[model samples]
Target: MPLYLTALATLLLTALSLGPSFAHVLEAPPRLIVWSPELWREATVFNGQFELFARIGGPLDVAAMLAAALLTYLLAGERPAVWFALAGTCLLVLGLGAWFTLVAPVNAVLDSWTPGPIPSDFASIRLQWETGHMVVAAAKFLAFASIGIAVLGPRLP
Candidate 1:
């Protein structure tokens, strides 16, 4: 049961983290830029709307994941068992932390980059930021999938 709960947590978080894949991005010829400026605006607005939803409900989801970790500890065994549960929890935590710390802010900067920008370097920086966000997002997906698979496959002990 604990393992299932852990898997559920990972599954939910993964879906949340990666579920917005098509919101603001699309495939262009060679550069991965917004295919539709209108779509970019629409997607950003939609994201803002869902963010209100997250504000109302996101913490509860996080709390559930934390609770699942403790439940695994209590329902399972001692050190080694707890360790696996902890790792599963940590993968989500670490991935989210990476998203907020390392990726999302750069995304914000890129989104705010202007036509009358400071320098050509700003565009280059925006490109780098976009690339980094994609990499970090992919890493988040990997972490999420790993957690989900681990939880599905075995108990902590």
Candidate 2:
């Protein structure tokens, strides 16, 4: 069981970390540049990379959720194990929910954006989009960290 938990935790951690890692590389640097519709549109183009990452990472969430469920079932009657499983499951839910509600809408708009003149409302929309991504990244990082702690916390001492 410990080995199984360790393996699952590693996979979940790696999967969750990808969001922030990619965001840092792809999204963070642009904030340092002058904000413009053209700039924003260019940034939108780069977001396609993130979309690709999401397509791959999205399925891992389901695997993590199932791991939690299986852990709960296997460790039935063990309070800590059950709680950890619940925490892992809840964190996944929160992270994915934020992604869909906060990030996906922005992604849709970005996908349609062209390279020409920027839209008048681009700044406001970009702010929302960037802010939404930051929020989702934080949620995912927390979820990953929580799962790690839950799985490995006891063994530490």
Candidate 3:
């Protein structure tokens, strides 16, 4: 029961932390890919706002996952601790990895960009950034599914 409570708490925190980022993802990418340079510049300012939110929000997500992992380790007696740990860890890794490797670089590029001319490689960068979002979403979905299974698996007949 304690483990279930912890997992639920973690799940809720994850959702809270990710909610802003998800909003940005849904609204930003497709339009960004199509925007003119002047519009892109304006959008970059908006993106910066979300970046700040993400910076503030991401650590909370990681902390919640850590708490979940610790709870699973300490309280999951006779339950599949390994499964919970893997899911939780995978979620952390996928989110952080995408941010650092994929999103961050493109953000840096966008940050430095001026409003006159779009860079030649901007399309490719946008593709990579969007792809990173997709990958992160998929990983998160899998992790959530795995956690659900682990939490409920032993209760089933």
| Whole-model lDDT values for every prediction | 0.51, 0.63, 0.64
> Taking the tens digit of each residue's C-alpha lDDT, what string does model 3 give over 36-57?
6556556654456456666777
TM-score computed on alpha carbons, candidate 2:
0.74
lDDT: worst 10-residue window of model 2 = 148-157
Candidate 3 ranges beyond 4 A from true positions: 32-34, 45-47, 155-157
Q: Which stretches of candidate 1 lie over 4 Å from their true place?
A: 1-6, 21-84, 107-119, 155-157
Query: Which candidate should be chosen as best, given TM-score against the real structure?
Result: 3
Instruction: State the local distance difference test value for candidate 1.
Output: 0.51
The alpha-carbon lDDT assigned to residue 88 of candidate 1 equals: 56
- Candidate 2 lDDT tens digits, 36-128: 556557655654645656666777666666665565565456556556656766766776787789777877787777766777777667777
Better of 1 and 3 by lDDT: 3
**At residue 52, what lDDT does model 3 achieve?**
62
TM values, all candidates = 0.54, 0.74, 0.75
Greater-TM-score candidate between 1 and 3: 3
Candidate 3, pairs of clashing residues: none
Ranking of predictions according to lDDT: 3, 2, 1
- Cα RMSD (angstroms) for every candidate in the order listed: 5.3, 3.6, 3.1
Q: How close is candidate 1 to the true structure, as a TM-score?
A: 0.54
